[model samples]
Target: MASNKNQHFVPRCYLKPFTIKGEGAAINVYNLDRRRLITNAPVKNQCSRDYFYGQDDQLEKAIQSLEQWYGSVISEIIEPGYKLQLEHQYTLKIFWLFQYLRTEGACRRSAEMFEDMIEPTGLDSDFSMSIKEAVQTAMRAFAENMEVVSDLKVCLVRNATSVPFLVSDDPAVLTNRWQLEDKRTRGGSLGLRDAGAILLLPLSPTIFCLGYDPDVYRVPSDSGWLTLRNATDVEALNEFQVLNCRANLFVGSLDYAEGLHRFVDEFIHHRPAARHIVNFAIFEGEETAEHKKYRVVSKSDFKDAHDGIMHAQTISQIPSQWPSFLLRRNKSCAYYNGTGIGYLRQMHAAMIETARPFFKVSPYK
Candidate 1:
């Protein structure tokens, strides 16, 4: 019989090692929950887009390294009749499947670019079809494994306009409200508006994490929590009402720092009888200097008004050449009243892969 570690299925290796100019490359494994696993050694000498385009050798090497690391981490479940065998394998399979799907997309894009450069008229439909078939096969295998595991559902709430609301028992009302709000807010898009609060309520004892685009709402207020309404007051109120159900709210924004401030205040001070709230602030990495300076000034004003206010710029480290002022107001939120700070640096590659094809970069292009 295979050892427990051997029985442990490692997801297809999707991670790649790419180096920056001065910095070396490293293989990164980011789980569904956004937790990061960095390789022991930073793979060096691999840089440039050309490096990612070559043969399958580098990809094969990465897959081997990932399998080794994964086995080392999960070698303990070797019992002959482990009850959770299906569940464990299902989880790992899905995680790796998503990673592989994303890598496949990257690979296809790289191939397309190369073909375009070489022949001017890109690869034929047959090649595209082949890539799609491979991705579909990997996705199917992962999903089939999931059938043995119980399905878990999560309720998402957005665009709440008011301070207090209740979860409606009706699903139709909830659906309609969510749709209307989505249209009004352009999909509950992230950007700063005003101050608001996000309440997290868990229906089961499951671990919860959240991610959001900060450009969707305005900057939250520094006062922690407030009950204010903007143009979409009704939609926001309705969103909060729906969210009061089995849901946890993740809040952030770039426009309204005061809005975020009020959210923290309400979350910490009110201490709703629900699951703990996890706060995160997302920043666009490609913002201009003037825009970034404006954001810093605005965030500083908000931070100054509140105690224990923490901020993080982008989920990862900022470039050293960037101004020091950009670093100010960039620490994780230290306040704890059943609330914790989660600094998520990278976007979910799996989610990105699933959504990117449907989204065209240029409406006309």
Candidate 2:
């Protein structure tokens, strides 16, 4: 794929070296829930995007590295056109997928081995080859061509409202693309057509991790989980957009919804010592001589929030979805979930092939 050498999109091959420990099945990295190795999750030797997201410490390290890589790119390397935002809501969505995977079964590590630090040799060559192949396939599946941001340091300013009554911005917009407010709020749309209001906020400039399910709604935890089953339900959601920012959106899963709620629940609402770090201008009307622009003060002043966000504005929720239409429909949609047995089996075979070149113990082989 075409990628700027300066830009640091997480590539699969780059992550393969981290998946395996010392050569051999004894020290292999396996999933706790499935009791199997992730290398065996791909289909017909095809590594899926979920393979990377299914990892725990490794995936976290990838994200942290990507974030840092992006920071350096925007600062010292070539800058792209799109903007990035790192609000609490945005960071959590990216983090929530791995958080769920860690819970579902990403953390079963193999026993420690001194040989882990040694380079692959002899029979271990085949095992190492499998790790490399699986990672390469998965990276190919997840690859995307993202544009370099023009203003690399530009951060999306939220709560640009002219009214003070709507000053309390809901941080839920960080995880779920939409934010549910009292329908009676003054900043955006305020319609009584439904139980409350739904505000499809502006496209977040920053990118976040994709959740398990793409087509799902984050209903109130008390409502026992809700989904827009048909066109009517989808229309209902569309019609409720008071402050319509954009129709295109990426939906979050229950993990995202609940995690966001927990974050809001424990958030320190009042930060007295917080200084005015960023100012967002809210216009009462279109920019004209008579229209008045209100200033909304924010505590966040992130200069490099554009690092890990999607390159496209709103074609899809997941960044990898931008590659091709065919890729978009594939079962491996989200990067932060797991693929089926096919991918794992393919990855496992690759490792076995790697081991065939030289003779080794059965377990290691």
Candidate 3:
């Protein structure tokens, strides 16, 4: 019997609206013309090679070492009963036992310190030796920087294409239950918030290596107004930062792997959001090599998202008469300081607008 070609089977996969647990932020890594979401390909030397001193061969060796070690680490950490499998298109995120050391500065230090630690590892190959040294350095750093945060979690994730986000054979990464949905869904997992700092490495276009801090976000135990305020403010700030990275990728044309480091340093790492347009202009207008690499077009184009985040933070800090949900989408007020909704929506809108001119159909797609 010939099956009907026009048979309409209800698709088991469908989009769902859910919060990204802690951060609750969404970014348009979407290419509108292609009608598909764009992901940051984790290539080390794509946009710049400052980390590896501009040597492609060295970067390649480092990546190979990382790939080799990733398996052993997984076997040691993953417990039985956890059904995880290693897949090509998955994302890899590593976590530190200490929270503060998750900072970019500390991560940089870890890499440098690895050079020192490798002396004792006695690994023969340069790649193996380099990684062993880095691991040792990271361990020492973790011990030195240990805090009250939870135990370290080295996670590997199947991409958003899979539902329920669990694999059968790969090493277990996430201990918690994660739901996967369409990337374009309005309220979907555009970004994730973790308590620790992260060293996000893109192993390839599909695979990502994320190194996180030990702490995890949790709801406040106490119901004090100050506690709630602080928590909400943190969440809002995290959301803004995640969106900021997306804007940089899509609008600033920053390389997925290298652009993050530069974006963090310039915008959110140590510096507070510059509220004034002039300050933002100066930040964007500087004739730096990074600006050239990302092709910073208009100073004002970059300033919009910064201003929006600053405004959002300002609004979030004030004693809110309304609930947090209302605050996230409030768009009625015209001014940042005025009594109205939050600035995230406006910020994202501005990001999409800026990305429109640069939006191209993905060559890979």
All candidates: TM-score: 0.19, 0.17, 0.23
User: Model 2, stretches more than 4 Å misplaced?
Assistant: 1-64, 67-129, 145-215, 221-365
lDDT of 2 by residue, 1-365 (tens): 21222221222322222222311111122222232333422222221233433344544465556544433433321133323334422333332222211211111101011122112122353343233243333333323211111101112222122110010111111112221221222222211111111122222212211221121122221111122223332222222121111111111112233332332233223221211112223333445675454433221311222211111111111111110100111222111112111111111223333322322111101
Higher-ranked by TM-score: 2 or 3: 3
Question: Which 10 consecutive positions of candidate 2 have the poorest summed lDDT?
Answer: 163-172
Error of 2 at 210 (Å): 9.1
Residues 1-365 of candidate 3 have per-residue lDDT tens digits of: 21222210100000001112212132223232233433432222112212321223543354344434554443332343334333311223322222223223223434544433333333444633343344345446545543322222333322222111110001112111111111322222212221122233222112223333223212222121111233333322222333222122222122332433333344343322421121112233335754322232343454443321111111011111211321111122111212122112222223333312321211111
What residue runs in model 1 are displaced by over 4 Å at the alpha carbon? 1-55, 67-100, 103-128, 132-181, 184-365
Return whichever of 1 and 3 wins on TM-score: 3
Worst 10 residues of 1 by lDDT: 202-211
Better of 1 and 2 by TM-score: 1
Better of 1 and 2 by lDDT: 1
Local distance difference test scores for all models: 0.26, 0.23, 0.26
What lDDT would candidate 2 get against the real structure?
0.23
